[model samples]
Target: MIRLDTIKDIIVFLLAYIPPLLVFAKFWREKHKNIIVLIIITLIYLGGSIFTQNLLPFILIIFDIKFIKSAGTSYLDNKIDNTYNKTKFGRDINSVLKFDYNRFKFNGRNFSIFSALKLSAISYTVSLLISIVETILLSRLNVKLEGQEVVSWMSSMQLWRFIIIIPVMIIFAPVVEEFVFRWLFFEKIFKNRMGIYLSALISSLIFGFAHFNLRSFPILVWIGIFNCYLIDKKGYWYSVFNHFTFNFITTMALLIDKI
Candidate 1:
C-alpha cells in the first residue's frame, strides 16, 4: 500500500517540476532555438559528473595519474567553443573569454570590486527579504513549500562532503552557468536591443524555475537579472565574478549555519 507521506512527496515533486517543464517546453517549441544543444550539454554534464563522482578518483588512485586538470580544461574548452560556434554571435571562444577593463566604465566612471560587492549585497538582501515574505504568505495560505535544494543538501552534509563539493559549487558552477545563461542566451542568441531585454526576462524566468524552488523563485530571478546586467554592462568576466561572489557567500553562510 502507498503511504500518505509518499503520496505527499510525489505531489510536492510534481508541483515543483510542472512550472519549469512548461517554461522549458515553450522555449523548445520556439524555432531557431538552442534547446537541443542545451539538452545535449546538460546530459554530458550529468554523465561527466557521475563519472567523476564514481570512477575518476578510483582510476587516478590506481594509475597515480594527476592529469585531471588538463583533461578537464580541454573538455570545457571544447564545449564552450562548440556552443559559441552554434550561436549567432559567431565570435571566437577566446575573444568571448577576454576581460576588458575599459568596458567596465559606467556613466563616465569605471567599475570596481567595491561596486560589484555593493550590487551583490543589495541583491542578496532584497532577495532574502522577498523570500521571507513569500514563506510567510504561503504559510498563511496553508501552502506547504519545500526548502531550496542547495540549502537542504548543505544542511545534511558533513565537513568532508562540503570539502568535496565546494570547488564544483563555487567555482565551476558559476562559470558554466554564467556562460550558458547570460553569455550564450542573452548575448549571443539575442544580440539585438529588444531581443536582449526579452532574452533576459525569459532566461531569468527559466533560470529561477530551473532551481525548482517556489519560495526562492523571485530571488533566483533577481540574481539572474543581476548577472545578465553585469554581462551587458561590463563583460562576461564581470558576470562570472558576481556569480562566484554570490555563490561563495551563500556557501559560507550554509557552512556557518551547519556549524
Candidate 2:
C-alpha cells in the first residue's frame, strides 16, 4: 500500500515544480508566442525526468533546437554593437544556443570554449570538495543522505544504459536546465529587482531546492552561482558550455566507475 507521506511528497513536489513553470511561462520569454514552445519543452522535461533511466526521449530535444535558435541567435554578432549592449536579452543566452565553430572573430568573440572549460573545471572541483565535506559532516551526525539513492542508481547503470544517457547528460539536460534556472529564473524573473548577488543567491537556492537533495543542495547552489557568474560576465552560451562540460566530466566519472 502507498503511504500518505509518499502521496504528500508527490503533491508537494508537483506544487513546487508545476506552479513555478506556470509563473515562469509569463516571465520566461520576451514574446507571448514563445510560451507554447516553453510549455512543450517543460512537458518534455517532466516526461523525460520520469523515465530518466530510459533516456532516449531526451534526444528529442534536438528537434527543439528551432525554439532556441529562432528565438535567440538571429541578432548575435562578433561585434558587441549598439543593440547587444542595449538589450539584456541579447547579452544573455538561453539553453541549446549552439556554439557554432565559425563564431569568435578577431578580438570580439561570442563564446570561448577554452575559458568555459577552465571555469567549469573550477566549479566542478568546488562542488566535489563541498560534497566531500558535507558527507563527512553528515556521517558524524549519523544522517543518511537523501540524495545518495539517485547518485547510486546513476553510477550503477550498465554500460549500454550509461552510453544511451550521454547525450542527455551533456547536451539536453544542460541546455534545458540553463534555460530554466539561469535565463528564466535568474535573469528575467529575479535579477531586475534583486540585483546580481542577491538574485544569483536566491535563484541558486531555488535551483538547489528543485533537485530535492538536502546533502547536495549547497553543491548545486554553488554550481548555480558559477553559472550565473558566467552569464553575467561572459554570456549565456558560456554558462551553457560550463554546465555541459561539468555534466560531461561527472557523467564520465560515473561511467568509468561502472566500467
Candidate 3:
C-alpha cells in the first residue's frame, strides 16, 4: 500500500482527488437529472465508437470547428511594447514570425524557414531546462511522472504501442494542444479588455490544473504563459513548432533512457 509519508504527498493526494470529488458532487446533488444526462452521453459515445470505429473524436473535432465554433486570431492588437520587445532574440524571432498573407495569396509564401529553425533550437534548450527541473522533482516524489509506465512498455517488445504513442506525441499533441490552450483559450480569456498578463496567468493556471501534476504545476504554468505570449505575438505555427519540438525532444529522451 502507498503511504502519504510527507505533507507534500498528502497535499498531492488531495489535489489529485479534488477534481473527481467535485465531479461527483455535481452529480450527487442532482442524481436523477445528472445520471440521465450521463447515460445519454455514454450511449451516444458508445454508438459513435461502434459505428464510427473510433473515428468519433475526429468527427467531433470537425463538427466543432465547422459548425459548433472555432477560435479566431483575436487579441492580436492588444500587444504593446515591452522590455522583451527591445531584446535581440525577441526582435529577430518576431520578424520571422510575421507571415506575408498577401504573398501567400499571390506567390504562395507561407512562413519563414528561419523561424522554424529558430523555434526548434529555442524549444530544445527550454525543454532541457524543463527536463532538469522535472528530474529533480520526480526524484523527491514517490509518484511516477505522468505516463511514466509508457517508458517501460516501450522498453519491452511492444511494437504496436510504439506505432500508437510515437505519432500521437509528436504530431497530434502539438496541433491539438496549441489550438486548445493558446488559440481557443487565450481568446476566451482576453475577450474582456484586460491586462494581457492576467489573461495569460488565468489560462496558464487552468493549463497546469488540467495536467493533474502538482509537482509540475509551476513548470506547466511557465510553459503555458510562455506559449500564450508566444502564440499571441509569434502566431499559431510558431507556437506549434515550439510545442512540437519540445514534445519531440522529450519523447526522444524517454526512448533513449528506456532502450
On lDDT, the candidate that comes out on top is 2
TM-score of each: 0.60, 0.64, 0.53
Stronger candidate by TM-score (1 vs 3): 1
Off by over 4 Å in 3: 1-109, 130-157, 191-193, 257-259
lDDT tens readout by residue for model 2, 168-248: 778866766665677667876788889999999998998777666787789889989999988767766788788888778
Tell me the deviation in Å of residue 137 in model 1: 2.0
143-219 in candidate 1: lDDT tens per residue? Answer: 98787877788778998888787876677666556655675556655655557668898878867776668877888
Q: Per-residue lDDT for 74 in model 2?
A: 42
TM-score between candidate 2 and the true structure: 0.64
lDDT of 1 at 145: 76
Q: Count the backbone clashes (under 3 Å) in each candidate.
A: 0, 1, 0
**Deviation from native of the Cα of residue 39 in model 3, angstroms:** 15
For each candidate, what is the lDDT? 0.59, 0.64, 0.52
| lDDT measured at residue 48 in model 3 versus the true structure, 0 to 100 | 52
Estimate the overall C-alpha local distance difference test score of candidate 3: 0.52
Candidate 3 clash pair list = none
